[model samples]
Every structure is written in structure tokens, then in C-alpha cells.
Target: ACKKILISQRYRLQAMSLIHESLSYSTTYEKVDMSQYIKGIANNIQKYTHHTIVLDLEPCVLGMSDAMNLGLFLNEAISNASEHAYAKEVKGRIEVSLKYREEQCVLRIKDFGRGFDTNRSSHSLGLVLMEDISNFFNEGNMMIDFEEGTEIVFSFTQKKNT
Candidate 1:
């Protein structure tokens, strides 16, 4: 129980850090390209996991606030996959894809590693953060599919004025 609490606290700290970084990047909200930001996060995660990260990002733009929240969501999901998804002997693969359609942005992060039960309560903190962030956008929501591995999909509106 203590370990779970500690882990939850750590995730909270990471979410706060992501929010701070995004706020520091821009004052007034505007549509900004998110390719570089996603790449940067992937790069950072790859270094620690020594795993392959594949990115398929379309030319999508997002408001500063939305970007920050999404960044936080991705960070938690990716980190969870890297840390827990793979067996010690297996080299993991994490694929991230982003596409925009009809004023909505769809982001998918899939990991080729062992999957977990989304209904479990042990990993609620990260899941809660992702869900909360997704709520910020119009018609925003998240879904997790566990087949061979874990696939997390987040869909949200790209309305800049919001």
C-alpha cells in the first residue's frame, strides 16, 4: 500500500512538471505544431528504456493548454508502458501516432509489451490523469485496448479558441 501511494505521488509530480513546462512555453494560447514536442518526449523516454519509439505524427496544431495536458497524458501512458509492459529480456516497441480530422485530434500510443487490466485499481492515478486531461477538449475521451499489448487512444477537439 505504501508503495502504491508513493507511485501515485510520483505520477502526480510528473503531471505537475509537465503542466509547468507547457505554461512556461507560451503565455497566450495559440495553435502550435506538436511534432517537436512529441519527439522530444519520445527521445527522452527512449534513452531510459533503450527501446524503439516509432512516431507517425501528422501536421497537427493545438492550443498551448491543450498541448500541455496532452503532453502530460502521453508522458504517463508512455512511461507506464516502458516501465511495466515488457519483460526483462524483451526489447519493447512503442508506437505513437497523431492525426487530425474534422477539427478533432486523435492520438494513439501502442506498446508491444505485456498488457495490464485497465479495470484494476492499482494503476488508477495515471489513468485518472489521462481521463481528466481528455475532458478538457470538446468530445474528448480516452480508450485502452489490450490485445497483444496495450493501445491507448485519445481523441479531442482542436478548437484553438477553447
Candidate 2:
């Protein structure tokens, strides 16, 4: 099972790496202040179309190790929403939140848009990749709420940098 997960993640990471490479110049960074940059990204996306972007950031913080994990976690979540949420002329509402749970950290990104069938959602390349990445992140749980709107929640713990 672990091998399967790793293989899936490897494929997804390969695609992400290629996408990162194709960009002539990159705007995103490896590490960032959650409050500062999160808001910036929301503002930029909000500018293009009339979408309600919210940054529900908490004062809680994490170390570089944990932060990096959360960054990738959030990146994948937001990227998924940005790519496939299909809002037509208006952009979807995206909400990013960070909070510490005991010794762990939880980061969540939610999108209000067209929802997909969880059971029917094809274990496409992206979903497979997300599953693999979620496994590596330690107790990281993901769920898709497919009622009125689409919401993807990812909750995980952070390991401190040595």
C-alpha cells in the first residue's frame, strides 16, 4: 500500500516539477509568512474577477519543517481549486486557514464552487497524487464536501525542523 502511495505521489510530483520548470519566472516561494503571503495571493486572484476570497489565518505559527509541509499541502489544494473549479466569468471563493492543534498544525483551503462526486470522482492523476502526498504528511486527512458547494479540507500535524 505504501509503495502504491509513493508511486502515485512520484507521478504527481513529476508533473508539478515540470509545471514549475515551465514557468519562465516563478512568483511563489519555498517559505513564507502565512499571514503576509496568504493575503497577497488572495488579493491577486480576487482582482481578476469578483470572487470572495477570504484569509482566515490564525496567530498560531509553525517551524520551517512544518511550514514547508503545510505550504505544499495548501499549494496542492489551491491549485486543484484554481484549475478545475469552473466558475466561468466569476472566480470561486477560496478560503485559507491555519491553526495549531495541540502540538500539531492544521491548514485548510476551501473553495465554494461546483462540487464533484466523491465516490464517482475518477482517481485521476491529480487525485491519486493528492492521496500519495496526504499519506506522506502524517495523519493528514482529506475530505471533499459535495453538497451545495465544493470544499476540500486537509488536516495534518507538523514536524519541527532539527
Candidate No. with top TM-score? 1
The TM-scores, one per candidate, come to: 0.79, 0.61
lDDT of 1 by residue, 98-153 (tens): 98787878999999787986668346777877888888877898988889899999
Provide the lDDT at 140 for model 1.
90
lDDT of each: 0.76, 0.57
Determine the C-alpha RMSD for candidate 2 after optimal superposition of all C-alphas.
8.1
Error of 2 at 158 (Å): 3.5
Q: Mind giving the per-residue lDDT tens digits that candidate 2 earns over 48-101? A: 335566778765444434444444556556655655565667566777887666
